[model samples]
Target: MEKLRIVFMGTPDFAVGILDTIYQNNYEIVGVITAPDKPAGRGQKVSTSAVKEYAVSKNLHLLQPTNLKSEDFLAELKSLNANLHVVVAFRMLPEVVWKMPKLGTFNLHASLLPEYRGAAPINWAIINGETKTGVTTFFIDDKIDTGAMIMSKELFIGDEESAGELHDRLMHLGSDAVVETLQLIETGKASTTIQAENDEIKTAYKLNKENCKIDWSQSGKMIFDQIRGLSPYPAAWTFIKDGENEWNVKIYAASFEAKEHDELVGKISTTKKEIFIATKDGILKIVSLQFPGKKRMLAHELLNGISFSENTIAL
Candidate 1:
């Protein structure tokens, strides 16, 4: 078996955990590849990726390439002489980059192989009302996430779990998977199998503004899941019209009452300490929410300062 000289490639905060786990386990991480720093937020100050910040802190050899296909970048990558490549939460790789390493490139996915394969797996799993999801480590192939599977670890979803919560759990779960996958690869025992084909597979399409809008027409349970699935980030939102003065409101946390109701689906009723929106099957009780230009807070706190008139309706 070849001695492990690994090249790590990833960008978001989720990738940091997996990268750190490998570093802590005494792996020879010869190089780290992350995204280039760019301006962000209202202030527009330059911001580095989470992985870049961590890599700098550890003084690891780092490279932020604007183009993975460039000859210069490829030349630098080749000089690293890495035998193994580990990817997580990163962009799709060009064949030249992924195929360079001796033992081949493998990725840690947030969902099981051939399922929930896309940009936002954790959010879609919860948004689709799935009760279970897991992490998978697989060797890289030409296709995205259709690689031969090495190993997977499953986890049950809580009834009220948000994507943020599930993301953290999966990150830790990925740590264990990384160690096992490395052991298998280095020991020459990593027997990968082709992914199972299923016609009923679900995809995690990327989240955008159009899809993030909350549809009151959906059942209360579905709306509840939608809110939780996208919570603590790009939240589900609706137009709150209070006596003709309308504004967008983002719902972060909520509870639902699944029952037969005659009220209009988008009708909004409010109390001094509560806000309820009627849905297809029942009422959706808002727990945490954010109004335009304000931070997210408890529902009751919002109701305290902003009272909706009788014309209250969530559009």
Candidate 2:
């Protein structure tokens, strides 16, 4: 059978792996669609999307449309004569675009469908304390993540794993799943299962500043999960108050001790080499953290530069 003609759409580093795999396997990629260049960072210099960078390096036919529904963009996309469209970490598509290709468009989502179906699947899965999460390749429809599932690959989430760690694992797994789905489609052996609608579905909404704030009133385990879920980026944050001075701190790593504690929630207990905060039912031993305007460091190292007063508490 002739190789499938594919048009790839994505914007981040996660999508680069899948695009590379497809190219390395000698599949025909007719075009690559990615986000437009935008000013970013301290200097406000223009930065390109990861997909665009890779596409340029390979000299693939590229499209960076400001509007997906524009006639010019649609005309260019239609001219590609692509049999299938593969999306990884791209934005939602209009029906006209997704329905244009002969084989339809499929997206590589970070979680198993019908559950944790939203923008931040990997982070939300760990935040919700799930022990297992996986990647899924599904047909894209009008609604987000509400489409027929073509293939899925599951992986175990480590007890101490952060979202960043799981993201790297899923990135590779998702690439393999995308390649397998394409081959299955090319062979006329692809099958899909309808996603059932039910109340048991857990939605993975986008993370925001309010949601990332740590609530000391929760159990130690819950707080620990929150810290790990957002670790290394948009970390779980809390306000530390000492007398009249207050500062915001982000917790990157922590351990939970479920033993009963008499101290009030949010109270801080510190030693020369350790920092512990009281939770509703136990204690949270902070291992890694970052203070406002300071680089991330171990709790002991942070303690070396700053001292917590007897009345210090996390608000």
Candidate 3:
């Protein structure tokens, strides 16, 4: 096998894991392309991507191009003399960039091809209540995620798993998948498959704040899944009107109980032990929550402070 010179492009914690794997496997990472540092947080400090930080740590040559198609950036990339390029969790590439590498550019996507073939794949699969999802490595083309597939690996979505939980699992799993794909490419034993367009296809569009709000009209299980899908970040929230004061409550950990409810739907019921909110089908017991203008806390602790009486309806 010829010694392969590779250029890596990615920009998140998920991408960082795969970058580390390639480094450890003795793959010659000639250069790393990551997103430019931008202002973040209250302090407005310049924040570098996780990939950039990792690249600096390993003393690898790094590039942060604001525009991939710019002549200077393309020239710099060509200087690396890379035969192959790897992309993960990065923006769509231009033809000039993807076509520059002789061995062709390949992307390690988080979902199985022809399904969940968009951004936020892991989040959408769990949000839609799918039983399984996986990762894929494919050649890069002009169309987004529509290319000849190199290989794919499927994994079961564990019961009661949240998006964040599944994300961590796929990150490590994806690293091995990329390494395996590269091994096949090196041995010239890799084959390609055309993607199928069927009605069973799923997409992972980006999650918005409006969609994260909990809807009480849904069944307890559906509401629970929504909450779990968005938990820990961009959380599932509900509003409670306390007289004229509206309180935003972000619900994190919850469980569904199909118990006899004496109150109307969307009503708040509370005991010293738990705080249950009535849904269309059953009550959702909120084990963890955060009141407006306050940090996250246990339901028991929140119940002690806030007065969630009979008329306190969660929006």
Candidate 4:
């Protein structure tokens, strides 16, 4: 069979893995569509998208368009005459573009369809305390992540795994799945399954700073999941009164102490080794944290200098 002409669209590290897999397998990638470069960081230096960096290294034809529907970019996309367009970790494509390909456009979503079907699926799945999360590839439609499924694969989430750990696992799995899907498509053996809409839908919208505040009123298990879900990035935070000035601290790693606390919820119970905060059901022993203007450090290290008074409470 003739090699299928593929156009890849993606912007982040998650997408790079699948792109590399396609190249390794000798698939014909006619063009790559990625986000345009923008100024980033304190220095405001211009930075390219992750997909752009990889495309540059591989000498792939790339298009970085700010406007997807612009006539020139649309013409460029049509000029490629690609058989399939694969989208992973990329922006939403309009019908004019996604419908242009002969084999149609498909997206690789981080979570199974009809669940966790928004921007940050991996983080939200861990945050919501899901026992299992998987990846899916589906045909692109008008709604976000609501398309019919082409392929689905399940992955187990360990009890003690963090979001970052799960991300790495899924990234590797997703790469292989995409390549397999491509091979099946080329051989006219690809099978598609329609997604069912049920009441069990859980959205994984983008995380915001305001949503990272720890709610002490929640149960210890809920709070624990929330902390781990946001750990290492957009961390779960709480405020404490520091000499009449409120200080915000982000908690990265914590475990439930399974202790009975006589203190009220949101009260701090600390020792030289750990810092436990009373929750609705139990206590949360914070192991790692980051305070304002300071790097992330262990709870014991922070307690060494940032002392908590006998009557202090974590708001």
Candidate 5:
């Protein structure tokens, strides 16, 4: 068997776990490629990607490519002379790059192949109210997430799980799956199944402010799903008004009751200790939220500081 020399590619904290798993297993990581350092957060401070930090901490050869197709970047990638490439949470690869490795490149996607095949799989799966989502390791092709599957493993989605929670679980599961795939490839025992075309697949559309905005007219369950799906990042939001003052609020946690309610849609009902919003068919209780210029807090804690009148409505 030919010894495997790997080049790993990814950004974000999610990829760090998988890359660590491979390194711990003693893979010959020839080079690491990640997005360049860029400004982030309220301070606009330059930040290095999670992958870069891990690579540097372990003294791995690293490349920060601004353009995947640039001659310099390509030459650097080629110089690594790696047989395999493993990508997780990385940007799309040009043909020249994905096809460069002798053992070919593979990607670890957060969702099962042929479903939720896009950028925001974790968020979309919870938003769509899926009971199950999983991880897949597949040979990278020219198209996005449409690749020959080497292995897949299933995980049950908890009814109360947020995208952040699910993301952590999938990251660990993916680490295991990727390690298994690497072993199969190294031993020449891998058998890949080509992904089939399916129009009914639910896509993980890129998240944006437009989609993150909360709509009170939706059913309590739907609005609830939206909240958890977007929680911890790009949180679901709404405009809350107390007849006199309106505040755009970011909702991080909530529960829902599907019973019919006479309260006007978007109405915010508050007891001394809790807050609930009327939806199309029921009520959504606000658990954790943030007000503009304020940190996130429980609804009751927020109410202690800022009261909501009976006329208050979540717009």
Candidate 6:
């Protein structure tokens, strides 16, 4: 069979793996569509998307368009004469672009379709204490993540795994699934299932400061899951209050122990080497944290530099 003329679209590190897999397998990637470079970081230097960097190294035909529907960009995309367009961690495409290709466009979503179908699937899944989550490849439609599914792969979530860890695993799993889906399309064996509508569907909306705050009024396990789910990026945060001095702190790691206690929720218990906070059901032991203007460190190391009195509370 003739190699499929694929146009790959993506931006982040997660998308790079799938692009590499397709290229390494000798698939014909006619073009790559990625986000334009933007100024970033303390130095304000221009930064390229991970997909752009990989495309550059491989000498692939690349297009970085700020406006997806602009006539000039649309013409350039049309000139490629791609058979199919594969979107991973990329922005939403206008119909003029996604529907231009002969075989149509498809997206590789981080979570199983009809559930957790939003921007931050991996993080929200862990935050909601889901024990299993998976990736799905679905045909692109007018709505977001509400498309016909071509394929899916499931995986178990480790009991203590953080969001960052689960992200890496899904990145590779998504790469393999993309390859398999493409192969099926090449052989004219591809099939799709329409996603069913359900009111009980869980949505993975974007996370923000309001949602990332730790709520001490919740159970120890619930709070622990929240901390782990957002760890290492947009982490779960709380205010540490000592007398009149209050500072915002991001908690990166913690463990929970269900012990019946009369301590008020949000109360803090501290020692020379450990710090525990009372929650609705039990106590949560902070393992690592980052204070404002400070790097992340172990709880013991942070304890050495700061002292918490019995009256201390995490507000």
Candidate 5, position 199, lDDT: 77
- lDDT (0 to 1) per candidate: 0.93, 0.93, 0.88, 0.87, 0.93, 0.92
Task: Show the colliding residue pairs in model 4.
Answer: none
TM-score of 5: 0.98
Worst 10 residues of 1 by lDDT: 303-312
Query: Any idea how many clashes model 4 has?
Result: 0
Please give the clash total of every predicted structure, in order.
0, 0, 0, 0, 0, 0
Q: Which pairs clash in model 5? A: none
Candidate 2 lDDT tens digits, 30-103: 99999999999889999999999999999999999999999999999999999899999999999999999988
Native-referenced Cα lDDT, model 4? 0.87
Candidate 3 Cα outliers beyond 4 Å, as residue runs: 259-262
* Candidate 6 lDDT by residue in tens digits, 1-315: 546899999998889988999999999999999999999998999999999999999999999999998999988888899989999988888888889887889999999888999889999999999999999999999888998999999999998999999999999899899999999988888999999998999999899999999887887888999999998788999998888889899999999989999998898898889989998888899999999989999999998898988888998
TM-score of 4: 0.95
Q: If both were scored by TM-score, which would come out higher, candidate 1 or candidate 6?
A: 1
Spell out the clash pairs found in candidate 6.
none
Model 4: per-residue Cα lDDT over 1-315, one tens digit each: 446899999998889988998899899999999999999998999999888999999999999999999999999999999989999999888999989988889899989777899889988998889999999999899989988788888899887678888888898889888988887888887888788888878999889987778888888888888888887777889997645667888889998856666788888868887888888778888899998999999998998887777666788
In terms of lDDT, model 2 sits at 0.93
Model 5 misplaced stretches (Cα beyond 4 Å): none
